[model samples]
Target: MRTGFRSVTAVVPIALAALAYAIVVPVTPARATPLPSRSAPQQRHVREVGDTAITTMDGVYTLAQATRGGNVFAAYCKSCHTPTFHSGPPFRAKWYGRSLVDLFVYVRREMPKNAPGSMSDADYTLAIAYLLRINGMPTGAKPLAADTAELRRIRLDSVPAASSPEGPAR
Candidate 1:
């Protein structure tokens, strides 16, 4: 009887520990290899009047917009994230193949961690532009429009072949 009680006590803690780990660690599915080179013609998806496929490589945001986003990031996000955090594997794991609208909505809804939804919608969109620029997405003549439909139209299909380790190019 005592031996059975001891066994139960030991197993209870182990079971609880396993339950806690399962609850805490999120499981992500295996991802495909990262796509390369925004400048590749094969990689670019042209958005025509009736055509719907558009990608980040198609110049989704402007330099000025990214610059403004950098400022907003410095003010609110820099406390926790360095510019490089927005690029490379980490960014890809979270955002690759997703639409920019996902990013916009995420930041608008759950960012700043302490004060979620604190910034203007435009500001959130601009921060996403900064993230794209740092990831080596080319700047467009026009800024990223802060519209859900427009943002949803552009998907992040590929990262650039070369991203500056220091930050976005000045």
Candidate 2:
């Protein structure tokens, strides 16, 4: 008998037995662990600014941050996204009412598809700053902090209306 033929015959029975065992045996789903209790303080998405809420409408990030974000996007994110993907009405519609923290968490956890969360928190935050700039949000005197707690303060509402040369219309 040929060596290959003998090996095939020997393996077939073992494969068939394994298959039969799988079919015959009942598999139970793993028990789910209970979620942690909310003993931690709740995070607030809105930051009060006098009578108004501080949102993306106000300057939350800086031009320098946005510029660095552009480079980051070109290096890592451009393969999957066009500049247009981050701009205009569609992006705003999807992201509106979500806090910057939501964006930061999402990108940090699931971006770069092949290797998620590879970038530092600062890079992800800068990428968000770029998105904000392209969408026509104003820049602040301060750069947007990379910290999640700071990011949570800014709610991403609608893209603000275009302001006149002097300032936003009342």
Top model by TM-score, which number? 1
Local distance difference test, candidate 1: 0.69
Report residue 170 deviation for candidate 2 (angstroms).
30
Candidate lDDT scores, in order, read 0.69, 0.66
Clashes of each: 0, 0
| Tens-digit lDDT string for candidate 1 (1-170) | 99988866865654554356445533322222222334556444543322466778767777877887887787668888887677877787888888888888889898766466656666777788888878878786666777887777778865653653235433
What candidate 1 gets wrong by more than 4 Å, as runs, is 1-51, 160-170
Q: Give the root-mean-square deviation of each candidate in angstroms.
A: 14.1, 17.5
The pairs that clash in candidate 1 are none
